[model samples]
Target: MLHSRETYQPSPSFTQPEMITIILLYLLIALLASVVGSMAGLGGGIIIKPLLDFFNDYDLPTIGVLSAATVLAMATVSLIKLRISKVAIDRKNGFIIAFGSILGGFIGKWIFNFFVLEIGLEQLIGKIQASVLAILLLIIFIYIKFQKNMVTYQMKNKLGILLAGVLLGLIAAFLGIGGGPLNMALLIFFFSMDAKQASINSIYIIFFSQLSSLILVGTTTGFGSYDLSIIWYMILGGSIGGLIGSIFVQKLTSRRIERIFNIVIVIMILINIYNVVKG
Candidate 1:
């Protein structure tokens, strides 16, 4: 499951030169992944997991840690931009969902550490993860394309927002994803939020949830000893991508960006499924 030259601890068999090459690759992938994910409001989950799976021997919990680290950086950048841009967010709704997601993320970390580890549940979880990715990709594509006319939110959909928060939070914990995609979709489709507002609010929501997730995972999961440099590179690359994506988004239609995002997601998910099935 880990790379031969384990990222957390380099193997004696591999030279430093080889490790540097791997790190460079990781950086490149991070840039591309974040650009696609941030543009689409999916919080980078669709790409991060599969990329990690293919490149290293990271366990799920470690992936969770890395994911949290990267998302934290992106969220911080996004939050600062939103503040400067004076983007208005429905804080009442954003906070409520964030509260649920934060709690759910902690619970998720606990489940991953205690139950999944104790029962050796990685195999089952892997299969389920692959399946979920496939379904999510398909749904994202359909929602982005055909649902344009139907995609609208009602002011009265308060109950739906609460429900979405809890559900997405649970999923975030289990998958090490930021849960922004689902929440943003809900806000866009059910709350009548514009693209910019949804994006800004998602930044805050994901930030808090990831912070809470890190606390739980750190307390119980022990960091899995992955290379700290990988975390840094991922965050750095993701930040750069987020800045570019946010700027490009201001002048573009949501539908256009969504179409491009869906294509990348579908390809990644298909590759992920193929890997899981092969394994």
Candidate 2:
């Protein structure tokens, strides 16, 4: 159901060298996204989607598929590396949120297929996604800016965490992201978790969320709907980047990563705005 490379057909416009170069570019981007996403407790989609949009002419569904593949690779490799390095994954709470995220992914993908794909509402959906994401990212930035560390203020609210995961999963699937910004925000600001730990847990949450998304998209979009071969390039980069990022995560501080994360979000919002207006 996933990684169906059989459907890939490189376009006639590119020669062999050109195709290899483009694939290399995709790999590089995925690698960078995974590295940053891992350090910041995100699943790396926010970075991947816009860069993919800026560099290529692929449609949203194709982007969604590629984005899912990238996130899956990042999550898998990062989780493995972290586990081997003895990083705590917070299996208790992380799994609670992940389960909810899985359910939400199906719901999100159903909406995407039926409303956006089937009805051909790409423009409308894109606009809505851009607008909502811009607003949310801004809110997250402001919220984090003012909050002092209440690191020990424990939130054992299972229901709340689950609901948050559902929301994150739905948004991730709909927007073709790994819910990095949102997930990191949830862990760092609301739950009072440390940045490094939150980042690790964020990948865990994203792993299951993206898995559900790929399965759901495969069912709805069918095989060969997009160039499946491109996913291999992205996955390779994401895997390597994931392992690299996990190894370096302990050396960095959350505050520094948070600042960089917000900057990236602002830039992404600007890109989204430009796309919306240019449309």
Candidate 3:
């Protein structure tokens, strides 16, 4: 079921100054998340979504929108920085994956709307998302921990690559995550990409998938009742974080980046698990 647009009114208890402070706090969180996300090629949304969910400041839909916007901003800036620094991406495979992600983005959003609006299961959806995310992160963490013993491939089949993108985008869009960890793991396993290469390509895939998802949201529900006041702050934080993270990626070795990725994944897993219980 489709719903009409509604404006979100701030709580009457929060004064103008208080609201500003709250927005600033969110900005700080976004900044920190973006830095870690960009450096590890996790696209920041994985961190942002669970943390925002923890605060319980906004509804699930609003949180999803905010996370998507911030991730898109971070990805844009990060890609630009990489380009300027002569970091080459696998454009053929990247674009193929991105095209598939766009299709997946559309389907994922439709499913989300169906559950949230049609079934009226917003809270349940949040819990489900958190639980699934936690489980997936745990699996990825385990895989990363013993990756040396696993058989990796150099997948060159375009159709397989496209299907992989679809699956990645579907999960990411549905969970309101930027699909960073999954992208990293899949890129490494299927394409035999090193950590640095996977990170760069992960951001590349995130940019297109997230952009498509946001476009679908805007075109269909027109932002619904999500808070817009903190959006500018999110953009500012994302841009700054993207710049800093890109520079760090350039300076750091692949081993160092993997260490950062592992640390962040563990932290995210804990946070998401808490969200599941709290929700």
Candidate 4:
């Protein structure tokens, strides 16, 4: 199924006007996703998958590749700006996790291939992944909306954090997200980082994981035929949005953004649930 040679050439049904509208709409959505996703420390990748699955005609593999690329664009802008601003980053640990993600991402691609080709569950896999992500995001959202005190753990579990990267990478490939939300949660809960620092770390975590996933996706998926224009739209939107979101987060404090983040997560959860049922 993944290796199907019957490609998507432009059809009369898939008209130029419709394509232009799609491009503009997706561009705006990606921009918003990156903006809020940056401030919220979720790296914008989480928002791309379910939304694209809902709206676009792209397949799961293409969706995954595009999601990773968009996240990469956003993360690149954010990280570069962070460097210019001289904000401190936990480089050593972040790189360690990224190193593990390299292998984990490849393994995840293999799993994705099996699911898509062997089991013929390409669309089903996306739906299942979206459903699980929605549930997890819902739990986090509920905790955020209701909990009075956010717990912060001591940063004593370096080895555990490093080991956790494997799962993060797997999820990065599986869900087409950079694992920003999960990384932020882990940092705050176990690494004793505040939401601000957690957001910073989450950006790097996303960078590494998404990079790995993108590399594996190209090789494994064999991007022979498909409209590549969708990718450029995502890149343009994600890049600009990432810069804006990074600046926004940096200018304002993360404490305020947390509430908005919770709300956004709830919205995404509802959207995912809808997609799951509809799919």
Candidate 5:
């Protein structure tokens, strides 16, 4: 009973030419975001969301599709690299997170289409994302200030991992993130995992989440106005970036690398928050 004309909404910012330009720009952005994401466990989704929001006026559903696409592409590259290195993911935790994230992804897409989109909730979310990012940045700075040596500490807890995974699922669904920064924070704070382990595990988490989210998106709202032709471009760029990042990880000390990289993330989050609010 859905009327095609009734359901169709016009894009305010992205004309056909603009969209093509944005797609091309995304190829470069994907490379940079993937490298930083892989090296620091910061994630490409957060980077893409703001860009899409600023340039394309992408709604939440569109952000979800684009976010999922970025995660899928980047995770696939990371998965292949990890396989070559013989890294083993915590399968139990990954599966638990994936299960919850898949359900949340579906619910999130439904919520966007049925409610948020109609109510201009995407604009509201932009503000909230800014606030959340600011808070997260402050927390990171505080953690670094008070507990610089926490990197040497190890607090492995399987139960805690499961709980973090569930929370991550919810956050990812809401924010269009792959839950990398959130997961990285948990691994560093609660689990006390080192940078190398955290980075490797993050890729594992993204792999599962991406697989599940992709299916949810495909079955739900479909890819809103996406030109499927450029998927190969994203894949190619993301793979090269991921490979370079993984190599960079091996060259750096885990402690120094983690602390420095976390500082960068904290800064980026603050900037994103500022931009979203200013918009």
Candidate 6:
């Protein structure tokens, strides 16, 4: 069993060089993941969460917190870039969705705590998360592959949009993924947005949802037991990656973005599958 949150500390056995190497690795992962995630509207947590789980360096809660913080940074930077570029967002729907996401974030965190602290099934929860993520990724892959044949709606109902946001936030928070591809997929299907549009709006949604989730974590558990030394490195990487990705998104065609999104989905599915089996 993992140590309690009050007692757990990052392992201190690594030599100075080893610690530096690990920090560099963390930065690289955050950079790469954020770049691709920003381009594809994934918020990067989808990639970061699984990779961190694979590393087996920290407990699940710490990993979730770190991933959330990193993605929040990426989303914030990406959205700022978009705003500066004068990219228009659907403010009415966006704010409604964001509000719903805040509610869902709280509920999801509560559920996660229940499973980990009350049920005492940390390992089981990890495996379950991996398995579910893999399955969801597979479903998304198939949907995207055949989305050309699918019928999409341009929904304008405020209640429906709010509910959709809540669902997206709940899934993203519960899975510790920043609701990247899933957000894009929902936007495409429900909002009838094209690839580039979905990517931009998805980042907007991610910023609000991740920000709310992190606020909840900070005000409650306060990141006391986690190894937060590497967080600054990851945030820096995420910010740089977001800048690079925003530039690319502006240059790339929607078709190109969709292609990149498809490739990312495939890789994420494979990684989640590996995590599930390894667990």
Which numbered prediction scores highest in lDDT against the true structure? 3
Question: Where is model 4 poorest over a 10-residue stretch in terms of lDDT?
Answer: 4-13
TM-score for every candidate vs. truth?
A: 0.85, 0.89, 0.96, 0.90, 0.82, 0.95
- Cα displacement (angstroms), candidate 1, residue 183, comes to 2.0
Q: Which runs of model 1 end up more than 4 angstroms from their true locations?
A: 1-14, 149-151, 155-160, 194-197, 224-229
RMSD for each model, in Å, please?
4.2, 3.6, 1.8, 2.6, 3.4, 2.2
Model 3: residues with Cα > 4 Å off, grouped in runs: 6-13
The digit string of per-residue lDDT tens for model 2 on 165-199 reads 89888887777777887787787765677666678
Model 6 spans > 4 angstroms off: 1-13
Candidate 4 regions exceeding 4 Å error are: 1-13, 143-151
- Reference-based lDDT, each prediction: 0.68, 0.77, 0.87, 0.76, 0.65, 0.85
Clash pairs, candidate 1, are: 1-57, 2-57, 3-57, 153-190
Spell out the clash pairs found in candidate 2: 41-199, 42-180
How far residue 146's Cα lies from its native spot in candidate 5, in Å, is 4.3
Which residue pairs come into collision in candidate 3?
none
Superior by lDDT: candidate 1 or candidate 6: 6
Off-target runs (Cα >4 Å) in candidate 5 are 1-6, 10-20, 103-114, 144-160, 224-232
lDDT of 6 by residue, 1-279 (tens): 223566444434567897798799999999999999899888899999999999987778878888888898898898899899998787778788778887888788778867875676778889988999999888987887788899999888999988988888888888889888888888889888888998888889889989998888777667666677788999998999888888899999999999999998888888888998883
- Candidate 1 backbone clash number: 4
Sorted by TM-score, highest first, which candidate order results? 3, 6, 4, 2, 1, 5
TM-score winner, 1 or 2: 2
